[model samples]
Target: MRCLIAEDHLLSRRVLKELLSPDFDCDIAVNGREAIDSFVLAHEAKRPYDVILMDIMMPEIDGMEALKSVRSLEKKMQIPSHLAVKVIMITALGDPHTVIKSFNECEADSFIVKPLTRHKLATELRKLNVLK
Candidate 1:
């Protein structure tokens, strides 16, 4: 699958890439704006990303905002229902309120904590049915 990773931290991005490389074709975005731009460009190119791993905190346009933007764009563009990309939010914050908000209000497909282990990531991917 084609995946996009939106993360500001270099080490986190690198670790995710290393962990998921065997299972997917991945693209990296340093910030939320770039993530949105890359997603749009990829979709326009007929190579839409299957999933996106988004970091909550970012320099330009936070992940939640970016998620809303992406959803809006998908609606505006009339993208097919089946072609909608899934977004999984990743962060170090473990606030229950934020997690609840992310699930109910932000409409994230899933949430993953930072400093992830390969086993945990794999399990999460399996839960999403993104892993074989």
Candidate 2:
């Protein structure tokens, strides 16, 4: 499996990479723009990511805008809904409003509060069927 971890915080990026390393070949993006670029490049290379863990806050572009762009790109590519990359929005904000916005606005497949743990990730992966 391939995964993209998009976060600006260095420590958080390291932790997420470590957590996902066992199962996925990981790519790191420090900001939302980089994440979007990685997404496009991966597809061009015929190795599109199976999952993306996106942070809501970042430099340049915020995760929400990045997420929208990604979804739009997928649509333009004519990728079916089921074939689109599974997106899990990650953030420190656990508020219901933010969570609802993530899902309602960007079509995120899951949302994970910060201090991301193995269990939370695994559960979401299973639900998304990115993990069997």
Candidate 3:
């Protein structure tokens, strides 16, 4: 699988890369704007990511905004819902409101609360059927 990890923290990004790179082709973006650019570039290149791990609190644009943009882009491109990139919100915020917003408004495929663990990530991916 191809994955984009959008995280502002250096250590978190590094750890996520390490965990995912073993099984996926992983790319890193430090913030939401960069994540959007990378996503667009990949799509334009016909090499769209299969999954995105987006951090909710980033400089410039936030993950919620980025997720909306990504879904909009997919809609604009007329990509079928099944073919749309799966987005998993990665956030330190564990509040019910944020979680509800992620799923209800942003329409994330899944979520992982920080501090992220390999098992938790794998479980979410499994729920999405991104992993066996």
- Report, for every candidate in turn, its global Cα lDDT versus the true structure: 0.87, 0.95, 0.93
**Displacement of the residue 37 alpha carbon in candidate 3, Å:** 0.7
Candidate 3 has a TM-score of: 0.98
For all predicted structures, in order, the TM-scores are: 0.93, 0.98, 0.98
How far off is residue 78 in model 3, in Å?
0.4
Off by over 4 Å in 2: none
RMSD of 2: 0.7
Against the correct fold, how does model 2 do in TM-score? 0.98
Candidate 3, 32: how far from true, in Å? Answer: 0.7
- Tens-place lDDT per residue, model 2, 11-112, is 999999998999999999999999999999999999999999999999999998999999999999999998999999999999999999999999999999
In candidate 1, the residue pairs with backbone N, CA or C atoms under 3 Å apart (3 or more residues apart, or in different chains) clash, namely none
Best by lDDT: 2
**lDDT per residue (tens digit) for residues 9-122 in model 3:** 999999999989878999999999999999999999989999999999999999999999999989999999999999999999999999999999999998788989999999
Q: Give the RMSD in angstroms, all C-alphas superposed, for model 1.
A: 1.3
Candidate 1 residue 50 Cα shift, in angstroms, is: 1.0
Candidate 1, which segments miss by more than 4 Å at Cα?
80-82
